[model samples]
Target: MCHTGGCCILRRNRAGRRMTLSTQTTAPYPSLARACTVVLILFATAVLAYTDRQVLSLLVDPIRHDLHISDTQMSLLLGTAFAAIYGVAGVPLGFLADRTSRRNLIVAGVLIWSVGTLMCAVAPSFAMLFVGRVVVGLGEAVLSPAAISLISDTFEPKRRGLAVGTFFTGIAVGIGGSILIGGGVLDLVRDGLFAATPVAHWAQWRLVLLAVGLPSMLWALLLLVIKEPVRRHDQVFEENLPPAAGQNSLFPILRRMAPVFLVVAVASMVDNAVGAWAPSLLIRQFGMDPAKVGVELGLLLMLGYGGGMLAGGALADRFAIWRGRNGKIELCCLAVVATLPAAVMINSHSASGVMFAVPIYFALSAVVTASGLSAILDATPNRMRGRAMAISFFLNVAIGAGFGPTAVALAGDHVFGPGAGLGPAISFTVVVSYLLAALVLAAAIRTRRS
Candidate 1:
């Protein structure tokens, strides 16, 4: 390979054309082993980010019981407060990711969110807890765009699905790990384990929060060793030009890719809604215990969410390789359709319902989700990707995760009146959500095809 001062490297582009791309970061064109390590670290970081977020749901009963708040109020802590601020912070952060050191951005997010997590542990009132969640959201806002953009730079488009999907497994793993690890903490707190220690006055829920939050501060230091990977570029589309400091034109690019972004937001609403509310439904309707359900939820989420995310990436790759651009979208549409039955069955009363239905719903969800994100990465040029992802983050979180759970809680509290309402609430949410997702996904397929 021809190179300049051992800094610049020669590489082949996708179009059977050779192109020489610049290496701007510390370790340019890093080895596959190094890249894999980067992915794994980011994966772990993703796990931490999600675990911090998901702990609230498992601790929901305890928090609400102690806080004396309604489900409606709790829903804000879970989704809106976090998602909204995360989305708001992400746009500018996305612009930064495009221009500066994504490693720095990522690490900063980790430290900030870790601090926010600790705030949740020490918060004395409902208002304070809500404020803590907002900070957590603000801190977490940096991860999606920065991390996804980093992954995009590390891997080629053909393999980006699997790479991004693998990164996303952090979502499942963190979520499951939260329930798994938090369950143990929940047990200890109940047994007065932490109370017996110096922090005798601490509540069970607060202890659980502290257990997860405190470790994250030290873990953020691990990321400092990993140098930022070289930013990869498309052979045909890129000029590899740096943006003028203030010249952030993300809107035009977003407008051009409106259809694809629409699918991301709509699809995420359904996917995140289920995640936000699934556990409460199980506990509320099935009369399951928190610790017991945590174990089950952990195992099921790992299998269902982790497997689904991985499968979706691999499937998107295979379909696109075999068919064409629209092949990826078709696979996405099919995955959306596949979830419909399981979505409905999740609310069923049969013993078999919880056994089979829950996993199926989770698995098919990522099939839809992974492809949508990968599609966004596919549509946008590498230079503009950070902003693109930031926009998607805003829409998906604000509309999807942010609102998904709140909508369910409201429906249950007002429409269904608490007890029997959760099942129907979930049923109505998923069925309508998946249907809307399918219609939008189908439209995206046509737009991509044309």
Candidate 2:
């Protein structure tokens, strides 16, 4: 039976040995229940942030009509404006997560993003709404780096990929949830679902943002229960470091990560581009409604990547063990080979053709994540893990999230301006991104520790 938030309790019987579970971090069968609880909290945070982030896209037509803005202006607000600042802010937050209490930072970020969502809901002008989006990005900057670091500390390498994969499920689910839920909300408000409230149809979108954005406040409570894992002590390996050297500095870690970072950034860019542009492409080209788009994408991701991520991690780890190779290397090579088809399928003309392509794309995308994340974490010392994630995130966001969609949007507007379909244009752009990703990831695979 599904509990609150759809949690299910699974029981195993082995020679009549009974296992009881609690949601705590302490070991010797440390609470799987507690681990799931923390994951649930992180999932909620991802859901809230991602949902509100994309709400602007769904509401773009309405916002443009109400505020009288141009597509170039909308592109600016969506891309460079938010991304520039987010890239700058993410590094410092990443450093802080490494040096300080990650859980506390995550809690604060949740609150910050929630308020930003509320601001978006009530914004009066395009500039004000842009400010809200920027705030949301800034706050969200804290999450992934910190969350990755925490997962690294809390779980061992063998199982860490699956853990990270599970966390990212929040992202897939959140995006899909936003599209599906936001569409329904918009329809209701537009159709006067709450006509007695005396609010404008556009203003009702704000209420939707506020309602979906606030649940993270309750999720913040998960931090209180998670026990902070001990930071790895250099003293434990005194010979590894010079006696006079400082412990917290990350330059050493960054130096080691240079090659790996290049791969992570490019691969992630391809992934984000496919995600950001797919909805708009389908809508503009295929004439699908927002709700249908959301449901289809959400179900695809849930079944494909959402579930595949967990399986990929397990399989990669096993493959690594079987071949006596690094899991990261195996995973990267697999992703490169697997994703090539998805890139081709995206450009397919028929709707049925593209529909069949979805699972391949998602599954390939899912494999890259868990392995890449584990590799990055393994490459850095505990003190530098947060910064490494931050740097990785900055590159991914700036290139992938920022430039990916911006490029697609610009292509759609200029190259495919009138009669040219969005599917061809987006497909062209996404394929280029994926090709670049495959090359970079191949480089990463070659460099993996033997």
Candidate 1 structure, TM-score to reference = 0.87
Q: Write the per-residue lDDT of candidate 1 for residues 140-242, one digit (tens) a residue.
A: 8988789877887787655655777788788657766667666766776778767557776888788888878888888889988777767754422223323
Instruction: Report the lDDT tens digits of candidate 2 across residue range 1-450.
Output: 221222323433222322221121223323566666666777767776677666666655556677788666676666665577679999999988877887888888877777777787788888997888788788889998888777766664445556777777776566556666666666666576656664444465566676556665566676567666554321111123332222445666555555556656655566555665566666666777755666576556556765656666676666655643355656665676677767777766766666567656877766776566556654455446677788988987787667766776677778777467556666667566666766765665566542
Q: How close is candidate 2 to the true structure, as a TM-score?
A: 0.80
Measured by lDDT, the strongest candidate is 1
Q: What would the C-alpha RMSD of candidate 1 be, to one decimal place?
A: 4.5
Best by TM-score: 1
Instruction: Tell me the lDDT of candidate 1.
Output: 0.75
The local lDDT score (0 to 100) that residue 301 gets in candidate 2 is: 53
lDDT of each: 0.75, 0.64
Candidate 2 weakest ten by summed lDDT:
234-243
Clashing pairs in 2: 23-34
Count steric clashes of candidate 2: 1
| Residue 108 of model 2, lDDT score | 84
